[model samples]
Target: MKIVYKTDTLPHVQQVSELFRSSGIKRPYDDLERLQRMLEHADVTITAWDGYQLVGLARAITDFSYCCYLSDLAVQKEYQQNGIGRNLIRHLRDLLGDEVSLLLISAPSAIDYYPKLDFERTEKAFIIPRQA
Candidate 1:
């Protein structure tokens, strides 16, 4: 499959929501307005497309200098395990450069996946859970 990566375009909300659902990512797929807002506010969005299909995405908010919060990384279930996710992260890193630190709160199922990608597991992070 010839996958093309793009940093300039934000995929439509419907495409993103569907990918989130199909990828088993726990996102507000039923809320299009929220999804749109999410995409609109993100500072960095990298998408992988196989022709016209969006196969993977990495969305983040960053200062382009010090820190980046990778809020979402999703790859369609059929496209998982193909290194798409890793490539997405790598692309994000290339954009952020060496001085920036990337941070993400992993979904329960993805806790183990991060370490294999050179991410350090740290107990130092804390969160106030969203009441949604």
Candidate 2:
């Protein structure tokens, strides 16, 4: 199964919502409008496809100069363990260049996964929980 990656395109919202649910990501799958807005506003999006199927995605908001917040990284369950997620981040980093700092708030289940991918764990971050 060959995967094609694209940076200039975004998969349909239904496809992305399905992938997020299937990949066990903590997102508001029931809120289609919110999901659509998420994709529309993200500054950078990298998607992985097998033929026409949306298999993986990495979505982020960035200024392209200082910092990048990787908001979502989801891969279809069947497509996991194949380095698709890693490669998606790699592509984002390549596009962002070395001057930008990449950051993400990991789901509780994925806390260990980031360090394995060379993402530094930080205790200095804070957030105001979403009120949705």
- Give the number of the best model, judged by TM-score: 1
Candidate 1: C-alpha lDDT:
0.96
Lowest lDDT block of 10, candidate 2:
23-32
Superposed by TM-score, candidate 1 places the C-alpha of residue 27 at a distance from the truth, in angstroms, of 0.1
lDDT of 2 by residue, 1-132 (tens): 999999988789999989999999989877889999999999999999999999999999999999999999999999999999999999999999999999999999999999988899999999999887
TM-score, structure 1 vs. true: 0.99
Instruction: Tally clashing residue pairs in candidate 2.
Output: 0
RMSD of 1: 0.5
lDDT top scorer: 1
Show where candidate 1 strays beyond 4 Å: none
Name the 10 consecutive residues with the lowest summed lDDT in model 1: 114-123
**Model 1 lDDT tens row, 14-127:** 999999999999999999999999999999999999999999999999999999999999999999999999999999999999999999999989999999788999999989
Question: TM-score for each prediction?
Answer: 0.99, 0.98
